[model samples]
Every structure is written in C-alpha cells, then in structure tokens.
Target chain A: MNLVIVLLIIGLLMIVAGCWCLMRTFHLLKMTIGIEVAMKAVTLFLVLAGRISGKIALSETFVITVMVAEVIVAVVGTGTAVGLFRKYGSMDVRNLKQLKG
Target chain B: MTILSICAHGFIYGPILVVLIYNLFNHEFARKHFFWFAGTGAVWQILAAIGGFTALNQNGQTSYAFGAFWDIRLAGAAFFELNATRFLLLLIVGLVALISVLVAHQTVDFNRSSYTNLLMILVLGMNGMLLVTDLFSLYVFLEVTGLCCFIMIAMFRSRADLEGSFKYLILSELSGIFILTAIAFLMMKTGSLRYADLAGLGQRISAGSGQLEDLLVYAALILLISGFAIKTGVVPFHSWLPDAYQSADTAVSILLSGAVNKVAGVYGLMIVMQLFGDVAPVGPSLAAVGIISIIIGALLAVRQPQYKRVVAYSSVSQMGYILLALSTGTTLGLVAALAHILSHTAFKSTLFTNAAALQEQTGTLELKDLGGLENQMPVTAFTSIIAFLSTAGIPPTAGFWSKILIILALWQAGSPVLAGVALVAGILSSAYLIRLQRTVFFGQTRPELAKVREVRGSVLTAEVLLTVITLGLGLLYPYILLLLHAGGIL
Candidate 1:
C-alpha cells in the first residue's frame, strides 16, 4: 500500500511536470518527450500498484502492447502535424484555423 | 460448439484478417473495396446469427458458456470470465463496424490508408470491449477505443475536429482514471476481478453487512457509471458531446452516436447492473442522475440549432430514459432498456447519416440554413422524417413501445413522478423533433438547398436500410423482447 501510494504520487508529479513542459514554447520534440515521460510514469504507477497488491503484473504485457500501439499512433499524428507545418510553415496550433467554427 | 460455429468466430475476426491478408499482396484495392469487405462482414453476421439460433435450438441452450478468451491467472485468483453476453455484444459491434465502414465509404473522402485503418482499429477495440468481462480488461479496451476515436477525430485535420478531439481525449482520460480507481476499489473489497465473482460477492452480502458493503459498492458504481455516462453523453457530463458529434466526420458520427456511445455507455451500464442492481443503494442516486439527464437533455435539445447537435442531445435524453427504466430493476424495465438500445441505434444512425448527407449537399448542418430540403432530396428527407418520428416516440414505432414499457416499469416501481417525467419528455421529444422536420424539410426551398441533389445511391440505400430496420424493430418488438428474456436479462 505504501509503495502504491508512492507510485501514485510519482505519477501525479510526472503529469504536472509534463504539463509544465508543454506550457513552455510549443516545440514538437519537447512536447513529445513530455508525453513519453508521462506515459512512463503511468506505466510505473500501474506496475507498482499491481506488485504492492500482490496482483500479477498483467500490466507488463499491457504496457508493451500499448507502447507498440503508441508508436503507430504517434507516427500518424506526427505525419499529420508535419503536413500541417509544411502547408502553413508553423507548428503552433493557435494559428492553424482553416476549418474553425 | 459445431465446426461451423467455431468458424463463425473466425468470421468475427475476418475484417482485421482481411486487412492483414490484403496488405501482403497489394496496398490498395479497387475504390469499391470497402463495399466488398463490408459485404463480407454483413454476410458473416447473418451466418453467425443463424448459427447462434441453431445452437440454441439443438442444445436447448442459447448462450455460449465460453470463459474469457484472454484470462489472467493470479496466485490464488482468476481475474476474468467473458461469456454469452460478451459474445452477443461483440457480434453487435462487428455489425456496427461494417455499417460504419459503409457509411465512411459513401460519405467521407479518404485520401489515404490512415482513415480506414484507424476506423477498423476502433471497431476492433469496440469488439474487444464487448467481449471482456473483467473490469480491468474492459478498461484497457475502453482506452483502446478512446485512443482510436481520438486518432480518427484528429485525422479530420480541421481546427474544429482538433479542438473537439482534444476535449474528448481529456474527458476520456478523466473517465479512464475514474474507471481504474473504481476497479481498484472493487479489487480491494472483493479481492477478485471477474464479473461472476463480484456478482457472487454482491449476492453473498447478509442483511447486516449489506449496508456498508452496498454503500462502498454504490460509490464504486457511481464512479463507474459516471465514467460511462460521460462517454455515453448523458446530461451533466454531456457538454462535450455536441461539439464532438458536430465536428467529427459523418462516418465517425455514425459510429460515435450509434455504436460507440451505446457500447461504451449503455452496454457498460447494463453490465454494471448485471453485477450490481441499478438502484445504487444510497437513496436512489442513480435514479436521480437518470431523471436529471432525461429532463436536462430534453430541455437543452429544444434549443439546439445544429441538426447533429439536436440528435446528440436527444441521445442524452434517451439514455436517461434507459437508465431510469434500468433503475426499476424489474424484468420489464431491463427489457425496455435493451429494446430502447436497439431502436436508438437504428434511428440515430439513420438520422446522423441523413444529417451528414445534407451537410455535404447544402454546406451547413444548421437547421436555420436548411429550410425546405424535402423538395431537393426526397429520399433523405423521407428517411429523416421516419427516423425523427420514431425517435420522438410516435405510435406504431419502436421508440413508442420502449417508452411505454419503461413508463410502465416506472409505474410498477412506484415512481409516479418519474413515470410522469418520462411522459413529459416523450411529449417534448415530439415537439422538438416535429419542429426540426418542419424547419428543415417542410418550408420553402432556400436557394442554397435548390441544387442539393440526393446523395449517391449507396448512401441512400444505407439510410433506407437503417430506416427499414428501425421500423422492422417496431414490428418485431415481441421477438426482440423474447430474445432478451431468453438471455436471462429480463
């Protein structure tokens, strides 16, 4: 239980840190790094929680699967973002409003 | 199971398998490949349904008693067990996927492979969700589905879709947190993850020990249901739905409002009730949520200008009716809830498809901009009218019967107030829906709508098929009710 609490706190702090990182200048690489950090925090939190509760680490397999899925998704997202950047010469989301309501 | 029946499971897996097999030979097929793929899926569903019926007749047992396809073993506990309900839910999901693909092929402009591939993954996750019985397994599939939708929405590459997708992702993440924490609590209390075991624990509660355990259970249920309610777009948590539904591409909207919301929200709620009754032992909190959703969703829906938003809010209100009926915990109530789910999917899909087709023609989904469409797209307008009336609970329609059954259940449960509220909502439903039809299709044809031709034959056929099914559901209401009873739900 104590270990789970620690992991949860770590996950919370990592999220806060990731948000802080994102709030800095909107660099794509930086944002990606922060998100990856946050994901790792989440994975660690799940693993520790399972271990502390004497539960089997089904999460180990789950995280590996999710990571592979994330890579595919990130590739698509990055490709789209890059396409938008090339079209408009900017990566800032605030200025990209071709179809806004 | 018969050899043919086992092969039917292969059929459920056929879509993904087809994609993989096709990838081996060629990256692109003829432009009409989706039709062939979807046709195969449809044929698969019919075969599975027929096989399921045969299995029922021959064995005197209807439901397949399969364990969870992917079970996780612990030192002293088993964590998951999927069974007949799960299989049926998957079959329904498979059908929804094929329909969504057809809708996509007809409406959306797929520039590349990403769109179709992501859509299939979304369907895969939804199918997996319905087939998983463990709370944690369900959560995993929920996240998978959420991710798929987030990606699909982002693929629109429009500012509106981006904002909507981000909002949806944030809300979905929050709901994911709630589901996980609630599951953790359930694990803490029951020391098991299987639905059957949790039901056993819930049943084993003696009179004195029932209250605290029930309260904790209620709290967990509240967390779980609220998570699903947000995803389901029920009121209070429904603010995100209009934007998401409006901004998403037409095909995504069909899946979102029709299958995904019902699967993630309504089906999720029903499974929860199967484990723990809907009444939430803590002074009818779930009922309170239901009543508020019904009233608020209807009231807000009356003021919506966008056609898709109106359908979206109506879904919120309709979900309230479902939850209210479920709260009664009677056979009639459960059956009413299930029946409403079937009808809502049929009508809602048709409504959204028509709205999307109209938007494509007239360049706007706003009702104010869409006056007198009946003269332009006769088939679309007629199909929309049928869907709208049925949704508003007109007589001899599936909606009316389900609404009646729910109200009857409410009355049986001694909730005259809710029964009366449901009646008022039904009336309000008619008022707004009728207003929608009159404003959009019955007036003078605007110049903008003058050149709005009927959508392609394929889109029209899809809408008509959905409308026919909606009407057929009304005609075959008894048979569906019987199926529900046979499933031991009622």
Candidate 2:
C-alpha cells in the first residue's frame, strides 16, 4: 500500500510534467514526446490499479494493448510531423496557422 | 447462427471485408471503381442495421449480446452487444458514410484508394465503439477512429491539411490520456471496467464507502467529462474543431461533423450519463457545459468568414443541445438527445454537402467571395435553404421538432430556466445561419461567381437525398411522437 501511494504520486507528477512540456514547447517532435511521456504515466496508473485490485492479469493485457495503441499514435504523429516539416521547412508549430478562424 | 447475430457480426467484419477486397484489386482498377466497393458496403450496413433493429424489437429484447469467436459463458470475457440505441447509432454511421462516399466521388480527386481504405477502417472503428460492452475496448476503438481521422485529414499532404491533422492528433491524444487515466481510477475502485460492473456506480458512491474510493470516483468523473468534452468540441475545448474541419477535405469534414464527433464524443458522454448519472455533480456539470457551448458556439459562428467554418461552429452549438438533453438524465431526455442526433445528422450533412457543392462550383468557400448563386445553382440553393431552415429550428423542418423535444424534455426534467435559455438560443442559431444564407446565396452575383453553375452528379444527388430526408423526417415527426406516446416512452 505504501509503495502504491508513492508510485501514484510519481506517476501523477510525470503526467503533469509531460503536459507542461506539451504546453511550453513549440517543437512538434517535443510535443509528441510529451504526449508519449503522459501516456506512459497512464499505463503505470493502469498497472497500479491492477495491482491494488489483484487483477494483474487483466490489467497486464490492457497495458500491452495500450502500448500497441500508443506506438501507433507515435508513429502517426511522427509521420504527420515529417509531412509538416517537408511542407513548411521547419518543425515549429507556429507554422500551423493556416486554418484559424 | 441467427440472422440478427450475423448482422451484428457484419458490423465488425463487413468493413474489414471491404478493406480486404479494396486492397486485393490492382490500384488502377480499384481507383476507377472505388465508389461501388465503398457504397455497397455502406448500403449493406444500413440494411443490416435496420433489419437488426426490427428483429430486436420484434423479439421484445432490450439488448442482444454476441461474440465473434469467444465463448459467451466464460467469465470476464469481452463481447459485443446491440440494442435500439446502438442500432440507431449504427444506422447513422452507415448513412453518414454513404453521404461521405458520395461527396468524395465528386471532390476527392487523388488518393482515391487510400480514402476508401481509411473510410472503411473509420467505419469499423466506430462500429467497434458502438458494439463493445466494456469501457477499455471502447477507448481502444475510439483511438482507432481518431487515428483514421488524422490520416484521412492529412491524406493530401498539403500544408494546411498536415497542420489540421497535427492539431487534432495532439488534442485528441490528450483526451485519450485523460480517459485512460479515468478508467484506471475507476478500475481501482471497482476491479473492472465493464458496463455491467459500473452500471449503478452513482448509488454506490452515494452509499459512501471509504473516503479514498469516493475521491477516486469524483476524480474519475472529472477526467471522463473533460476528456469527452474535448472530443465533442464543447465551447472551452473547441479550438481544434473548426480548424480541423476547415482544413480537411469537404468529404472528410462531412464525416467529422456528421458522424465522428457524435460517436467518439457525444456517444461516450451518453455512456457516462447512463453509468454515473445518479452522481449529483454529473448532471449540473453537463448542463453548464451544454449552455456555455450553445451560446459561445453560436457567437463564434456569427463571425467565421469561411463556409465550412461556420458549419463547424454550428456543430459545436448543436452538440450542446445533445449534451443538455443528456444532462436532464431522464428517459425523455435520452429520447430527446437521440432525436436531436438524428435531426442534426440530417441537416448538418446536408449543410456540408452544400459546402461540397459550393466549393466545387464556385472554386472557394469564402463567404465574401461567394454571392447570388441562387439563380445558377437552383438545387444547391434550394437544399441550402432547407438545411438552413432545419438548422435554425424553423417550422416544418426536422431541427424544429428536435429542438422542441429537447426543450420539452428539459422543462419536464424541472430545469425550466435551462429550457427557456435553450429556446432562446434558437434565435442565435437563426442569427448566424441567416447571415450565412443571405451572404452567400441571397445577394447579387459577384463577377467571378456569375459563371458558377449548379453542381451535378453525386454531390447534387447527396444534396437532394439529404434534403428529402430532413423534410420527410420533419413531416413525420408528429406521427413519431404519437407512436412514442402510444409506446409510453413520451
């Protein structure tokens, strides 16, 4: 129980740190990394839930599935980043102003 | 083994089959006849949904559960379930996909095969979301739908397309993280994320176990609401919506506004309402979000210079109506929300189809660049008027009936103030849509647009088909009400 509480705090701090990185960064690649860090924290939370509930097997399956989905999201995010770079000649998100109302 | 079961299975497998067959063919041939493959699949889905709905109703079963290959008797196994609500959503999915394919036939010039592939996968994903009985699978399928949408938006690889897809991807992923974290929290308390396990969670929370458990539940509620709110593009979290809509291809925009937002966002909220509705804060929070979105979305729409952007903002406003209805947390409220969903799909897709027409004919969707197209494009002009009327809740249109039901539901749910506020918001809807209609279709033809003519072929067909649906549904609404009254659902 003590370990669970400690891990929960660490996981939450990681998520907050990741989101801060996302908000403070203009680099597209950095944003994707931030998202990845936060997603990893979510996976940790899932594992913690499983541990506390004694449903480790179910949560393990969920963690594996989430990892697969996260990787796909990362790949797609990078692919879009590459597309943006080729078009704008930079990875800065500031260039994404073409569609504003 | 049963026909209804086969139809249920078809929702999952049919799109996969379409994707398989689409890729199996050589590129040139497949590109040439992409519509036939995609169109047939959509029509089959429509028929199967209707058939399943009738069969389910006839058997007097509220929900039917089936598995693809797994045994149903096993403990803790995940499976698909279908009921009236899921069937209605499935039917809407098919209808919107068909409309999108029709519009794409006119607009999506390059990368036709890939468009078909991503579209079928999107359908598969939405179908998966609707069919799943567990929250975790729903999240997985929601991500699948979001991924497909991002790829489809960036399919052309233009600068604006990539920008829009990237914005949507980031925010959508953020929402995903929030949802996943909430699921973890909920699971910690309940030991499972299945709908069956979480059905009466509100009572359990109120029954008051430990302090930590209640705290976790409250925290999960907040996360879940915010996560889905981003997807729904409710006012505060709505920045990514118009940009994504305005930047994507019109066919994809039609899919986004007409189907994806509702399924991925509004439908998720519907699940939340069903499970956690008895929780005290859930209702008020949803109501607050709904009202804010309605007012602010209209105010924003009033200023958008682009055609699709206005419609996109209008989507934000309309989503508020659905959420408001859901917030009431009554059977009537759910019915009202479902009715609004159907009517919104009809009119919103009609509006987007008109956007496709205007874009194809006039070469731009800038409201200032367009004028006096009424004389030249009679069908498009007429359909646009009908859609506008429906959108503004004018009489003899589907939007009018749905909005009326929404207000009625709210009033009966004892929030007459919210109901009155909703009633007045119709004027705001009318304010912007009327501005749109007068600016683009009602004024004198600009010199450049003088040569514009009515868009023909599949786009025109989509326009007429959607207009007919709006009018028919509106005219039939009274009978629908009567039937509902007879069935004691009113």
All candidates: TM-score: 0.84, 0.99
Task: Determine the backbone clash count of candidate 1.
Answer: 1
Give the candidate number with the greatest DockQ: 2
Q: Kindly give the stretch of ten consecutive residues in candidate 1 chain B with the minimal lDDT sum.
A: B74-83
User: Which residues of candidate 2, in runs, are more than 4 Å off?
Assistant: B206-210
- List residue ranges in candidate 1 displaced over 4 A: A1-53, A57-101, B1-4, B28-32, B67-88, B203-219, B278-283, B478-490
Residue B235 of model 2: what lDDT? 84
B3-79 per-residue lDDT for model 1 (tens digits): 44464354337557655654554445734365565556555654664566556557666444333343345343333
What's chain A's TM-score in each predicted model?
0.75, 0.96
DockQ of predicted model 1? 0.19
> Which candidate comes out best when scored by lDDT?
2
**Over the stretch A1-101, how does candidate 1's per-residue lDDT look in tens digits?**
46555666776688678656645646544555555555566566555545544664554554575566446545644654565566557776565343322
The C-alpha RMSD in Å for every predicted model, in order, reads 4.5, 1.1
Report the CAPRI category for model 1: incorrect
